[model samples]
Target: MNVFYEEDGGFKVGAVLADNTTSLQVEAPHGKRSKIKAGTVLLKFEKPALSEFMEQAQHVADELDADFLWECSNQDEFGFADLGLEYFGHAPSTVEAAGLLIKLHGSPMHFYKKGKGHYKAAPEESLKAALASVERKRLQALQQAEYTAQLTGFSCPEALLPQINMLLYRPDKNTIEYKALEQACHDTGLTPPKLLEKCGAIPSSHDYHFNAFLFEHFPKGIEFGEIGEFDIPQDLPESNVSAFSIDDATTTEIDDAFSLIHLPNGNWQVGIHIAAPALGFGPGSRLDEIALERLSTVYMPGNKITMLPDALVNAYTLEATKSCPALSMYLEIESADYSVVSSVTRIERVKIAANLRHDTLEPLFNEDTLARGGPDYPFKKELGILWELANRLEIGRGKQGSNIGTDYSFVVKDDRIAITDRKRGNPIDKVVSELMIYVNSRWAKMLSEKGVAGVFRSQFNGKVRLSTTPGKHIGLGVDQYAWASSPLRRSMDLLNQRQLIALVRGEPAPYASNSEVLLGAVSDFELASEAYNSFQRNMERYWCLRYVLQEGINEASATVLKENLIRLDTLPLVTRVPSMPELPPGTQVQVALSNVELLDLAFGCEFKHRIELQ
Candidate 1:
């Protein structure tokens, strides 16, 4: 006897070896033997042969109309053979019964299985909804294929234009657009950004990186909307010294300046003046809230996002010829040794003598000029004395003031980049850095002594961190350091300035020691500041690549830092050459650059030859 049975959710035909009444031992057409339950057998037939039975039944099953079968059936559950008999107008033959069973089993949308060999016609509404869903999926599959084809052909689909940033930065993998992009990326063996760039989806690589950062950090926008008027302090006492600021030409937030007075007793009274934005607004105010949210000014290659509004920065910036409100730290130093005899902190307005720029000032006030000592410039006498005092301060800190490396500055104008390198630890750097360090350390000490709370920057065991508790900064060689110098650029500095002002006036500090608010601000500032700095570094790298392309640089010199890592000599670019041979660190070599991918901010390089040192 031949039997058609449901096994493992599929239909099969087998010839019976033995019938035990409850179970049958059968051999399949291919000679494989198996035992199946009697209840699973849908039909028994002795046809032309077992081998030909399945193919014939499948053909018949394919020829049957599933909709006609469903329409002929009643809503109640019934056996397939009974439905076949009803449709055929007589008892069904074995072949017809088997074909009907196969058709019913396959057409699940038309009929739902109730038990072995039993089924019920699906409800009209449910069946229609299921068919519609299947059709929709089929259409979506076709659309996805079309999108994939377009992307593979270096063309972006119109549907994916609005979602380009999300697809590149943070993709929702479940969406069909993302799926198509993923498929295209895999097919081309390229990253999403590179593939998109090839498709002309990314118009500007610079804007690509910039927009990605803004999308993450400043999602709403970079606009400072409708800031209310805030009072600028005008009642402060004016100091008896003419102060001057030294900064970059592009700088608009002039936070710190310097002054000098020759005392009649052969002592020099030096003044370190910091712009006092804290006096215009207090903690928990609207401006303070805005500053706290931004945390710090975000700097990139050619631009910056200021933490404070332009109006507030202009009102408090130490501009030339303006007596701006300041937090001044006066040091009475003995002229013979350049050592501080007494130091005092006061709030006053200091007359601005000038705003000196580095490009113009460095040529005249550098190491060689100081040695010759004849070229006269504005505030040259004060700067010369301050430079001497800075050297003495460096010696007092037990620092040798050796040059560390080169510092690169990027200037971008009209989409062109100019990268210039300045030697670290130069005379101008030492003077500004030492004086800022002195003021920060002294202010931290004063806050600690007066039992006031403030934010401090500390380094120990090669790790640097911010905290409310005062601690030594081993990196700066300071006893205790707080960033109280740039109130217009940093939120933490503004907070510390508020505390310092309160201490100077004998008023209550804005934040209490060990307060959750203070601790939370420290943690948030650390995270935001690090994020800002990382973005800055990435932008700098982007500009470095742009500079390479702009200057038509193909071959360049680099100093090897590790096995394959090297730092470019002309620009602040560090990259790896996979083809490079094993060389010691600090070995100079020439490398050939190729395949610069801006969207990914990377390049390919080949090792050329080693550069011998002179």
Candidate 2:
């Protein structure tokens, strides 16, 4: 006898070789024998061969209407033979019974299986809902196929227009749009960004990179919301000195400046004035909250997101011709040796005499000019005296003979970029850096002595860290260094400025000793600043590549750092050239640029020849 049975949820036919009471040894249609349980067998027939049974049954099942069969069945459960008998109006044949069983098994929405060879009709409501869902999924599959086809042909479906950014940056894999995009990307052998660009979805490379940063960091967008009005006290004490600031020409938020007063007691009193925006806004204030969210000014090649609003920066910035409130550090020193006799901190309004620009000042006042004693300029005497003190301070820090490299400044206007160079440890830089270092170190000392908590910068073994407690900063060769300057640009500096102001006034400090708030701020700022700095460096590198292509210069000089990685001399771009020969560090070589991909910000170069070892 031939037997029809269910195995692993599918119908199969076999020839029964030896029948036992509970089981049978059977050979399948393809001649493979297996021992199967008698309960699993649905039918036994004598006329049809085992191979032809399933084919004929499937043909009959294909001809029968599953819905009609479901409607014809009893309301309760019934066997397939009973249903088949009622449908055919006689004792059904094996093919009819098997076909009906297969039809009922396949249409799960019309009929639900109760047991082997038996099923119950689905309720009208459940059947209708299931049918509708099946139809919906069928339509979605068709639509997804069409979208994928369109994308493969370099056409973007309109449905993807509004979701392109999300699809590119943050994708939801469950959605059909993302699935179609993923499939299309696989077909085209390109990344999502590149494929979309090919389909003309993203046209601008600049916008692609810029939007990537915004999507990750500034998801809601970089806009300042409504801010409450603030009051700056008009009764701040006025000072006698006219302080002048030295900064770049693009600087609007002048943070620090200098003034000199020749004392009648034969000593020189030098004033280090820092713009005091902290006095106008305290912690938990509107401006303070704004600064905290941003943490610091995010600087790219030519653009920046200022921590404070422009109006606030203008009110606090020490611009020339305006006497702005300042946190002044007065150092009374001997005129002969520039030794600090006394140092004091005070808050007052000081007249801003001038704002010096690097482009103009570096030409007239520099190392060569100072060594020659040949020429003079505005604030020349004060700059000379400050440079002397800076030398003393650098030597005191035990960092003498340090030759830091150049700092590149980028200016982007329209599609054009101008890169300029400034030596890192020049006399002008030394003056400003040394004086700021002095103030920060001194304020850190005062805060530690007064048992007040502040954010301290400490570095050891080339790893820099921030902490609430005072610690030695081996890099600066100081007891402790707390940033108390640039209140308009950096939030931590602003926070420290508030603490310093409170200490100067003999009032309660904003941050208490061992304050969790201070420590948390330090940690949060460190993370945010690292991300911001990375973005800045990436953008700078992007602009450097742009400059190279815009200028149309193919040959460039590069200095070897280790083996294959080198830094280009023309711009601050460091990349690897696989063709580079093994050379010592500081060896100069010429390289030719070939492919410059703006979208990926990748450069392809070939090492041409070596210049010299320097």
**Maximum-lDDT candidate:** 1
In candidate 1, which residue ranges exceed 4 Å CA deviation?
18-24, 35-39, 64-82, 85-88, 91-111, 120-125, 226-229
Candidate 2 lDDT for residue 223? 84
Instruction: Write candidate 1's Cα lDDT for 478-510 as tens digits.
Output: 889999999999988999999999998988888
Candidate 2 overall Cα lDDT vs. reference? 0.89
Model 1 clash pairs are: none
Q: Superpose all Cα atoms of candidate 2 onto the true structure and report the RMSD in Å to 1 decimal.
A: 2.2
Query: Please, what are the lDDT tens digits per residue for candidate 2 over residues 74-141?
Result: 67988888888899999889988888888888999999898988889999899899999999999999
Clashing pairs in model 2?
A: none
